[model samples]
Target: MPDAGTLQLSGAGTTKTLPCHAGYLSVSGKNNTITLTGHCTSVTVSGNDNRVAVDSTDALSASGAGNVVVYHWGSPKIVSAGTANVVRQG
Candidate 1:
């Protein structure tokens, strides 16, 4: 995901450092940790115990249990589903 494109990930107990300038990012499966750089149009996370960091995003959708999302810039519209998911601006 080095340029503007869609990135979709699915797995368990994995760690990834994503590239910059993404158009959209989607994650499924559990216990995956991810870090996203640059700007993105949208970020969607599903499943449990996933941790995500974004430099900036226009929109964020987080679903499932115990997921955490942190944004560095912009006031993005957030839509959350399921239990105990945390979306924060930092």
Candidate 2:
């Protein structure tokens, strides 16, 4: 189970938007596009071919192959443990 102010998403080939609220955002699915609004404390992505864009974040962890994560602001800590994963500031 997720803690308070945590948002979890899982699915394939879908696009969605959600508010981060300075909390955690977790995504697990293939070929999904997720956009997070506001500041996020952390973000975790654990599925193949996923795309995530955040307005701001303190940390980002990606453990899935072919995943892309873009942060618009802040120098977030990044951990990438998957093949072909991309995490960058945009």
Candidate 3:
């Protein structure tokens, strides 16, 4: 995300607001190619497949953990209620 502070998400019949799952976010990587996984759940993005700005939409109850996203390009962005990881590299 270009501006982590500006990253927001929404759900079915829900308003567009910041992610919410629990209260933890985890981010990790080197020089940018990061890997985020933890307490968060349900994700949404704007772009993907290497796009500079990408968005991911999922359910917060299902992928609270063990959800891996492999993007060929773009920055590593993760925003949820539990945990998130955002970085720029590669």
Task: Give the number of the best model, judged by lDDT.
Answer: 1
lDDT-wise, the better of 1 and 2 is 1
TM-score of each: 0.94, 0.93, 0.22
Sort the candidates on lDDT, descending order. Answer: 1, 2, 3
Q: Among all windows of ten consecutive residues in candidate 3, which has the lowest summed lDDT?
A: 45-54
Candidate 1: how many backbone clashes?
A: 0
lDDT values of the candidates?
A: 0.92, 0.91, 0.28
Q: What is the model-wide C-alpha lDDT for candidate 2?
A: 0.91
lDDT of 2 by residue, 1-90 (tens): 223388789999989988777888899999999998888999999999999999999999999799999999899999999799999999
Question: Which residue runs does candidate 3 get wrong by more than 4 Å?
Answer: 1-34, 50-90
